[model samples]
Target: MKRFVQARAAAFRGAIGAALLPLVLGGCATTGINKGQINVISTADEVKMGQEMSAEVAKQYTIYNNAAVTAYVQGVGNKIVQHCDRQDIEYHFAVINKNEVNAFAIPGGYIYVYTELMRDADDEAELAAVIAHEVGHVAARHSTERMTAMYGYQFVASLVLGQNPNACAKLVTDMAATGGFLKYSRKDEHEADELGAKYLYAAGYDPRGMVDLLNKLKGLETTEPTKFDTWFMTHPATSERLARVETEIAGFAKLTSPVRNAAAYAKIKAQLPK
Candidate 1:
């Protein structure tokens, strides 16, 4: 009887320890990607915080106002989302009614497709390429990875590194407020390119959309986005990353089918914000 009572006490202690974990640890390292360059911080914390902050951003921008346009974005988005390895994520995608010629994703499968990108795509694969890249961010666990990196000094907070919880909270709050959820390092950029290309092929979209999207960003780098802060900082479409993506697709098994859905792409273009 005494042994069983002791075991019950031990079990209770274990439960208490588990509950206290997040408070002390702050939830870092969510994805399976190695501790290399990608954001691999605690995914649950980042996703929860991202959902909180996303609510604020969503309120400011009206979602894309057209049903057919929304449907098209959702359809392409759903196809790519399914092929992703992160089965736990639902990937809630929406079209933001902004004319910034950009798209981005948040942790926990929240993806945003701007009207500008929709209007900009000349083919359906172009859109798929973008979705795959965003999905790449999710799959790579870049959100949590970036958060771990973005906090930059959470290790300092831990007893393992430096033990500074207050500093850790400050760093996280700064990231949350500034939208530093996940921005890939150059290595992360290349890795996502590779994984995104793989997924692009898997989802039945030609990998060229990766190249096309990069090319478009290269051209657009000459211009400034309408609200230029978060997206630009993270997605640096460099010449080298772009070039490597081309090499990857070229090396893949040849895709005999046409990649672009030109007619569908154009019909939706008319509805986007100019």
Candidate 2:
């Protein structure tokens, strides 16, 4: 009898997998399909969650703003956005009124840059590297991957905690803190670098933006790790990654068609709050 029950359970699991196959396959018809099996969450769901969390964070912290700085950031972001295929999503770029040299992205195209990052950046191209990297996170749907993974874990967490459905979800979201562990696998990091590099090149920013940014961050780490923020926590900048980024940029011959916007960057820096 036990053997029969086990066989039935196996059969049921197989059936469910088969049924889910169509939903997964047909999901490509929807927007934001990049690679297979990595179903992009709906824009509505992404925006709702991102906006909620973003609002909470913004309320918790303050936003730094100056017309010049704000305009420069938006301009850099817009240059990269033009190269992206996902235009349906709303993208906003702003500097957070914080001392940390970091940048992060939310699911529905919400991105934040710390004033510290802007202040430390040598040129607009360096800022482009930061923007492109954050955009890669949104484009690849890393946020959704995190939420989906957490949901699967919550299913088991619910059974163990013996909580009501609503309570379980809240507990799971808080405990998992997807933003913290949104740290991707190694392959994902490499892919993001490639994507960032490509965007920088296409956006008319020198590919060296990536290399320069990585090197600058490396120097900062030598002085102190606590000085940097979201970039290090979310994305690693190892010596190896720096070497590869340099090599990658060396291959871009036409990138010199236009140079970094140094004057615009300096003008924006003057407007930042003390």
Best by TM-score: 2
lDDT by residue for model 2 (1-274), tens? 3234335435544544544465566664335525554543566766766665565556555777566777778888999988865677888887788777777675678788888778888898999998987787777766565544434423322333444435334523442232332555566677667777878888888888788888888898778777654445455556878887777877877743666988878888888776
Give the per-residue lDDT of model 1 (tens digit) for 1-274. 3234334435544544444456546543334445333332355555554565466446555677678887888888888877777776567778887656656666667777877677667799988888888788778776555544333323322512334535434433443334333445767667767777888888888788878877876776667554434545655555887888888888888778846788878888877767
Task: Please name the candidate that would achieve the greatest lDDT relative to the true structure.
Answer: 2
Give the TM-scores of the predictions, in the order they appear.
0.71, 0.77
- The parts of candidate 2 lying over 4 Å away from their true place are 1-30, 151-181, 229-231
Please give the distance, in angstroms, between residue 105's alpha carbon in candidate 2 and its true position after superposition. Answer: 0.3
- The local distance difference test score of each candidate is 0.65, 0.67
Model 1 alpha-carbon miss at residue 141, Å: 0.9
